[model samples]
Target: MNKRMVLILKHLLAVDDPVQSEHLAKLIQVTSRTIRSDIKELGEFLSKHGASIEPVRSRGYELKITNDRSFRTLLEQLFLSNEPHDPHSPDYRKLYLIRRLLLADNYVKLEDLADELYISKSTIQNDFKEVKLMLQTYGIAVDKRPNYGVRLSGDEVRMRFCMSEFIMNHSEKKQDEGLTSGSRIIHSEEMTLIRGVILEQIQNYGVMLSDVAFSNLTIHIAIACKRIREGNQVAMLSEDVKNFRDAEEFQAAQHIVGLIEKELQLTFPENEVAYIAMHLSGNKWFSGIEGQQAQDIGPERLLERRIYELGKEMLTEIDHDLNLNISLDSELLIGICLHLKPALNRVKYGMNIRNPMLDHIKTNYPLAFQAGVIGAKLLESKLNVNIPEAEMGYLAIHIGAAMERQHLNTRAKRCIVVCTSGVGSARLLHYKLKSKFGNRLEVAGTTEYYKLPHVPLHNIDFVVSTVPIPEKLSVPVVVVQTLLGGGDMDHIENLLAGERKYIFNYIREDLVFLRQNFRTKEEVISFLGKKMHASMLIRSSEGFIGLVLERENAAPTAYGNLVAIPHPIIPQSRCTVWAICTLKQPIDWAGKPVQFICLLSIDKNGDEPPSIMYKHLIEIVDHPEIVQQLLKCETYEEFARIILKHNLY
Candidate 1:
């Protein structure tokens, strides 16, 4: 019914456990009272759909479905409604308008757009202003005609690239659960055939692809086919394509194009083969090729050697920038090398690969993602290519995964599966688990509910089951769908909470300074750096300050609220501590006004992971109210009192 109501329903659908109202409020950046009111209103709407909120006092609320069919119908009506998106919201309306422009076969009228969105012509014009700015990034322009309305004008390739971004929106690898949605210009069967052909070729070439990259390739191929039939072809520099011809993936790409051309009854231009090769090189597929080749051959290729060396340099820069211990991760080294090989191709060809998870990754893993940006910067330094934000997002995925792998290797859980589903279903679920968890989870074994008793318990940390086990067990039982759906990994991560502890001890009274009248970010940072040096916490003040400023140049650490968590690019301090500075008033931090500055300096030789304490800091940062309260605090005890109430330790 309302935007908030839709958000609440989605959350309820996502989780099995009752969601606390406070949790929902924090998630959407609202207050508990607003969530409570929305819940009551949402409950009324759900009642009509054979679903109702089951409120658990002192806990939260859960969605109970009475009629599964009706609930599904309601979900479809709410999400996939004819309105496209909630026109009431500017964001949804912008998205709706983007889709319309991307898919339009003819010029679109401002009046017609207004009518579609149920908005005024003036509003449509204003919205189009934003849309034009957005399309400009893809090198597309709004070409307006008298009485003919407006159409997007750009290079056919750029037009198609822009279209791919909005059309399919890079829907997740899975069928239905991605945050973004895509379009289907052709029949589902045709697309399925295209996907099958691609996969067959990938296997024959002895290469692998991440699911996200695999899905991205499928959609790009589909777009290419559709564009080609309409007399549009990708034109590239002959020299660039020739370079690709030397690549193993170029040969694989030619085979792939030959198969697609035969099946679709179309021909691929010589450069188009290189274009396909670029796609092969850009995504996780290249890394897959690297992985496959490394195992089969004794020595690395020249390109592979370069990639490995460049990757090591990139990681060195990243480690120097972030002071994290991920450079030593062998898996990360291979992954970075693989990701970069194709990424270099993208830069060479002037191609853009949109990363849909870009925003989410930035928000979730600020430090790791920034490290990725620095990594991108390093690649840019040598490659001499202007790395776009989208490419940076793609880089972050690999770096973040590599960082996560370090955690997985040390603290990942081992679990047994209890399934009522048949053997075929059980196998699918097992692979899905592996795909999601990777090295983070080891599957002890899978057994039917009746045979679950025979499954060893001591060796297994927990149980993942298709059916609910009512009896009390020593380990936690995670009941999931037979499909091993979207939110399963998150639920599993929560179960492994015991494995990792938050480093709350990092924040000390000795490190914190309050109510300081700092006017600029530089002043706040300089003051804190000098203090740390004077106290013998840091070896050099200017050196430490330079590292922090360098990191800021890479990306702003001012993550929302009135709080800014600034830290040196690397660990220069003797030990970890939060060198905090609460400004007497708000100061410009990057662009946002920040009243609280938390300068985190990690111990060069510390027991904790860099990201663990960073994650803990984020929990406190999520609460603007807490930050504001801390700003009001003038003494160490008062600040400690407020932070201790969070009970993060």
Candidate 2:
């Protein structure tokens, strides 16, 4: 099947209900008639593979599986094929163009590229617009000459970084093996040799590198070898080279390079050795250093002191903003200090280290990720360097573990029983709660309804009352029968175990917009910001919108599942609220397709931690079915009902 048919099948497999041909056409940027024809052809292919596309009258097309085993085998064969390239797919073609330009020793003719891809010059020109934009992010540019065509031009270090990202780290190829373009730079056997050399040297030097860091270092060395053989060499200042020579990592780099030179019969310049030493210094981890004093780890006491101070400041900022109450976590402080040492080196040298857990960290630990963002911003300002999202992800893992530790160390929920039936009934309810919840429930005391006013509630989590308390109080009041039933026990248990509030509590009816015709992320954000301002929910729409955009520039807020939760860098409203907009058609958010947009504004003055709110949002991000249901709602009532019905915690 062609790329369009493959996309159609993937979309059909993603959703439960029939998808309209108009929707498919818009998604693929094709005409409705073309979609119909593609669907017909795809149906024929599916039928032979134990699956069929059935058209629903007045609706659209739905995929049905006839044989599960055969369909599974077909899916594996189609997706896992050993095709080196797909010239028919525009995305693949753009990647091919980029790899070709990066590997080119001189300017490559655009006509030659067009002929290679079997496409017209006009199509390739259009493709270059996107490729150029992508390259600009890495500070690389397309150097276009009138008759000579185009080639990649940038700082040698940045070009090598780009190669590591696009050629060596392409998602379609395994990391252990090289892609077609990467093979030109370094073969699998050569990569194995480089890895073995790195392992032996690091082992000999007592240096520890994580699996990701090791892979990145290996790729950098391989790229260095390729560039050196091609008569391209990295340049370093004399002072910097002298400083690296004094570091212990320089000795290890020398040994690794000396062995590689013998094996590959290529000479590495001194600057190349210094570059390898920089990578080693930036990626090393202090293994078995947990709980150890910072003074004992490094030779430079002043640098360790500075890192510790920065860690303390970062934790303080996180605690003040989110009210996580983890600033006093010594173990967390030690971990952050240790991590910052290597992280600062990587950031200072503009080295890009990949975090394999970035997506999982964002989805599973959003609150911690937000804290990571806060910490990264602080570090950026203090250190005068930009911290990439991958580094922020690593930071979040430490913070998330600290949050988990805080949770584990928490005391049981404390409550006071208020009964109108008298002391006897209050005592009965208190004992029943104690019997049911065990040590999880701590009953401070019981009191009569009239005397409850004098009962101290400062330390209580909630009020367990037999009679409904009409008057509002500081703590939540859960009313149950004199003889507590199973439902009442479950309610109390949820309050004790789950810190989450109802998802709709933060959602307002006036703020929910359904079936919006927003064509871009900017349009959607601007509309929501204006709505919030008009409703007097925020002080200034422009200021709020600018902050949201700044956060987006730092990292895109689109977290898959057709959802994009755009929020300010910090809390911007007096109270927390969500301005939700569901698009009639999906918009490209950064790179992900987003149909559901939740504009979040945290309460600036509230004492409650935002983690509970993030938990509810994570529930929506994790469930595609819930997002689809929300996207289909056309009215506020329908949206509210769906949110309340599927409230996970």
Candidate 3:
């Protein structure tokens, strides 16, 4: 465990409310002098970051938070990111402490934390200094009270910026030495504002980011600032930033500003040496230097192309109306506008665009509702003719902001369960697998080892096995003696951490039905039929699938495990809708099931087919006990509950 982590955990576990340094030192097994140094370090970090961590003369530290959902959200994300570290790594202990303390959530005391982490109070105190210093880099300030405790003070924007930078820059510095992006010409104050907006947006949307992703974003923003300072022009450089193995990528990002100087039609001044140094520091992109051949794709060129198309289209449509003329280049004003999108979304749509900045097209864009309307009209008349005006307006905002903002893709990790056989423990293992995963994981499928070699588990990023498999498994697999208890969660956590690097770019685009209605399942299906011109098919024959009762008095559908599935298998008439409704009240299905009703509709003879839909229906039917839980489900987001809890999917 990291010393810093141990220290933080010690405080959280041991320091209940507030206590004197002497008492804290005794609890943590450290001297009073060491505790004092730690306290000083903590105060310094807080002060620099614009958040306050106050220490009481006789008592201990207290953390104070405020409104501004963005900053609060950013802080939470920073606390959740846990990176592994070498025991000897500098501040490794502090980073670990930060994680535990943030998550303790007022549960354990500082004294208990000391006992758990096995660190001295003085060592714990010193860890605070590292925290305060890290926070300061992003403009958060920490304040201490005479006796109350330590608190963080600063508005949401500053707090968020400080948190992001601290997490991204400092977290990896211990392992990847000399890979820092160094200081740039961008003002610290301005950088804070930009960072705050980006962090706020991603968190609000519940998007997950990995450390590599966060680092890339940090570097991208830094480069954008340099380009903007050189001259407000869209920069097109030959160097690659991805797969940071090639030195050319480093040089490309470094001299990116200078490379576009002539194209940007901007004059440079002396002493703006950061841009020149940036070009030279091309070797220090992130992590380490490699000699691999770099990707040829240029971000600037792609962005320019997108901007040109948008600008040309906008001009052709409304040249007579707005008379807008815009040119594309990577620069500052664009970066600023990109940052503003998330802040604006918070102001406009109660959310933020994940992309840091969007591609810029027209030079001076309007921010009013009227601009929205005009953009909508132009897009409707020219591009995607099928979309509605309102959708066009929303798309306009996304595209406009996407052009200017920096964005990151968030992907969920998926795991598949391989059963040794189908009869005995397969069902038990299936339930156990989903139980092990919860929401963070996507459980693809559970199949016997005999069939596993042939079963194509879609999106199965990794695999877990109980018994040895006769054939070679394609995906990464972790063998376990049993599929229960602490071992499962640990394996799942590791799998999720590995999968975090790959994100889904077009998450919603692939699904045809749910794209329209993300909130409710019924709504999604209804939209598919009504808006998409697709019809639901139902079978009309007498021998067709229909619900049957065994006794004169039908036993309660409540299958006794708090699960119930109610369905009427009637013959199909015309292609009709299958009403899958969840009752506000749980109803009795069989003796064991809870309240869940799933209606399946089979299409009569027609061009529209039912076979494609039957396979999905069978998956739901075989799990009637599972379907009962679906009745209680209220929305599409709850689909995970039905799938994971019932093992229906």
Candidate 4:
């Protein structure tokens, strides 16, 4: 592609309203034939890539791509990767004319089309027949209506494919011809007005008034003008165009009045003017952003607000570190806006949202640079929600970091030191814990024993208390029992893995469990009894149910990825709800697979479960390796070992 075709695609993408072929031809500086061919070419491009472009009645083509980071990324790269070029090679000229005639807004006069292409009317007719036949292969058909003339309808893809082949043949010639001719016909004022319309729409519509919508609208407006000049009694406006009027039907008529008075330099009767305005107003040809405004803040402001907020949220969620900050200047923001606008459009329209250029953002704004993993996950889970590629990339970074941190820590277990105040003995206790665990056990964050009342007294993988233990704050608090033998570090590694919660920005609703043989229902009660050790009735439909597991909704666990892990971060009851179900076949949870269901209940009033269990759902989903092992496990023992031995957060 070259500059002109790119421009054409841009225009086509921008159009929100349907337009006539005549309008497209005029706007692009091509004969009706050339305009039609371009549309065909565009459609073909969309399909070959597994994307879509649609045409509406009295409107032009609209693009439809799956919404996701990957697609958004693809579209941005496509536009930015290469420049536009000529569509028509030498051999495609014949098909090009056929495309124009077929796609023209109104009926094309056989004589007029033939005269323009320097071919006989019969040749034009024959070309139409071939095009029509091709349409059938794509499951589309040509429709002929009385008074309305010849038209094509049916499967959108077919029309697009046929159109693409035809456009590819002639786009080049049209581009050259368009450049020389378009410059002479289009005025600066017109371009200015068009640009104004686009700016306004972007503000008013937010993401809805997409780039494709704008491009198509521009073509339609230009074509509508041509019909009026050709004595076609086209619609024009009767009243003055206001910013926000309820009687919009008359706006098109008014705009037409403005166009003629300005472009054609003519005046019209009152009724004719009203009809024109009505037509323009009723259709999407007019600017969708007419009443909206965009802030004139420098690019730096836009970047700071959007990038900083996004970055801060990312770091806080993924890493406990809160001191980092990211900032960008106006120059960088301008580039982001220019490049990211297209990327955003693609994502909003269900295309890939990821942009290769995003890598450059780090180089340009170094402070803001964090791995794209978290940012990408945040984008996919909260913004795009379509592509998984970015999210996957993010996961790799997270897991790598986790492994790195683990490697650096002298293979120590975690020990929570508790004390009152005075700072002297507390400091000594902390030093001792660190000295003893130094490569053997890690010292988690420190807190006062008294403050423990307000905080959830859980997640204490191991605790060393200088003072008498309170009734609460449980994790195996070792009363410093003589402060001898250092302390058993065998279980510290497991606690380290379990205590941290790795919140995944992306969560899918689908969960699949892969295991062999169902655990006997009786096992449910046994397991729950061992875990909870509380007297509980076996609530069941027919036979004894597994140990009664209870679930509490102290807080919500709904994250992204269409997934929600609901469990009491802390078990409050001795009775646990143990239930099992073996799907005859796999069922999709959200969009994944589901095989096993685990419900846990704890007696917060008594013994406390490990803090690692607090982040049961989040940690499991975040670690792909763990999820894989769990999915492939064949037995309950194996699954239990995997769950118990490995850390979730």
Model 2 lDDT at residue 237: 83
Tens-digit lDDT track for model 4 on 1-649? 4444454565555444444555444344557777677767766665655555677675455556654565566566555433223433322433444455434655655566567656676776776677666656545666766655566665332343344334322224442342324322134466456546545533543323345344433433433344344444422223332322344434434554555456455455454444333323322322222211212444434443664355445444434211212122223223323333333333332222222433223222211222233344455556745423332332233333333443464255556667665577677767766665466565675667776566554544567666677575556665653243434333333454443333321111122233424333234334433333323322232222221221111112222221223333222343323222222223333333333334334333423322223345445534433444555576556656776677332
Candidate 3's C-alpha lDDT? 0.40
Task: Report the alpha-carbon TM-score of model 2 versus the true structure.
Answer: 0.79
**Top-down lDDT ranking:** 2, 1, 4, 3
Model 1 has an lDDT value of 0.75
- Whichever of 2 and 3 has more lDDT, that candidate is 2
What's the lDDT for all of these models? Answer: 0.75, 0.83, 0.40, 0.42
In model 2, the worst 10-residue window by lDDT is 172-181
Clashes of each: 3, 0, 121, 104
lDDT of 2 by residue, 224-334 (tens): 999999998888789879989988889889999999999999999899999999888886555334344543443244246788789989999988777888888877887
Q: What are the C-alpha RMSDs, in order, of all predicted structures?
A: 12.8, 5.3, 28.3, 19.1
lDDT of predicted model 2 = 0.83
Q: Tell me how candidate 4 scores on lDDT.
A: 0.42
lDDT of 1 at 80: 52
Residues 9-61 of candidate 3: C-alpha lDDT, one tens digit per residue: 33533223443555435334457787767766754544444444466564455
What is the C-alpha RMSD, rounded to one decimal, of candidate 4? 19.1
Residue clash pairs of candidate 2: none
